[model samples]
Target: MTTLIRYRDDAPQQALESSTDGAVIIERLAALGVGFERWSTSRSPLPAAASADAILAAYAAEIARLREQGGYTTADVVRLTPDHPEREALRGKFIEEHTHSEDEVRFFVEGGGAFYLHIGDSVYQLLCERGDLLRVPANARHWFDMGPRPRFTAIRLFTDPAGWVGHFTGDGLSARFPRYGEPYAGA
Candidate 1:
């Protein structure tokens, strides 16, 4: 159940719009010059299932393609898995809404997550499952909820190799966007 929510940057108490429809999501994101797409795996050479050479080849091709299309130079995959004692605490206290100063992009390599983007008068609630990718533009103003830091993993992609250096919320507005549930597995 991937969703998209849009709203004013200063408010997160409620979404201006939200939906699970992929086409609608894509359309909304594309309007902001952001990219959102869903891909499926046939259990072949799609990185996770690939061997050393296969992985290298797949990335090489992707690098070339993205570089030509988006002036991308590198492709890096970073994974986050939390087993912290305060994982639940962090998740519970995780609703402090904020936004990246640049494009926020994530690809669910294994598990899933929630990406809530604040657009003008709307908050796009994106419930990203495995194989789903989301790109929220820089300064898009949003927050992420992984459900109290549950045992979830994801592969993140970024144009900036440093990755995920977010500007924390000082306004404390994350309380507004709609929360997420388990993604749709049979859709």
Candidate 2:
């Protein structure tokens, strides 16, 4: 399931709005120039791949469709488990508000994560679980939190094959926002 929670950046403890409905999620994100969609895979659990090339090859058709639709040039899988030693570093890297030159797109294959987008006067906290696909437009102000116990498998589509490069905004607003942790409604 996917959840969208809206809040005033300064009042993160209280949600202005929240929903588990997919249509509503898409509509709300779309209004912010972001894209949200649900996708299905032929298999229940995607095949395990040790390398980016293997992962890309495992989902070639899906990658091709995304590439055609978004002009993405690269596709890769990122799997992080709770025991990963670098989880803290990776989480810290994205905890600060930042923007990318190209759109940041991710498809969650398993587990989940959250993307907090700061647009205008509100902060949109999007909790994405399995089967969820989210695309944050180029230059969108946002930060991602994989939580303290990181566990997720995501397929990322990049406009540049070189992959993720973020420009920090130097604003420490992320700490004011709620971190990812609560289980999706009904899990």
TM-score for each predicted model, relative to the true structure: 0.69, 0.90
Best by lDDT: 2
Evaluate all candidate structures by whole-model CA lDDT and list the values in order: 0.59, 0.85
Model 2: per-residue Cα lDDT over 91-183, one tens digit each: 899889999999999988788999999999888889889889899999999999999989988889998857569999998989877789853
Residue 137 lDDT, candidate 1, scale 0-100: 73
Q: In model 1, where do residues sit more than 4 Å from their true spots?
A: 5-18, 44-64, 81-95, 182-187
Superposed model 2: Cα runs more than 4 Å off: 47-55, 182-187
Candidate maximizing TM-score: 2
lDDT of 1 by residue, 70-109 (tens): 5444555544456667766667553566766556656565
In model 1, state the lDDT of residue 95: 55
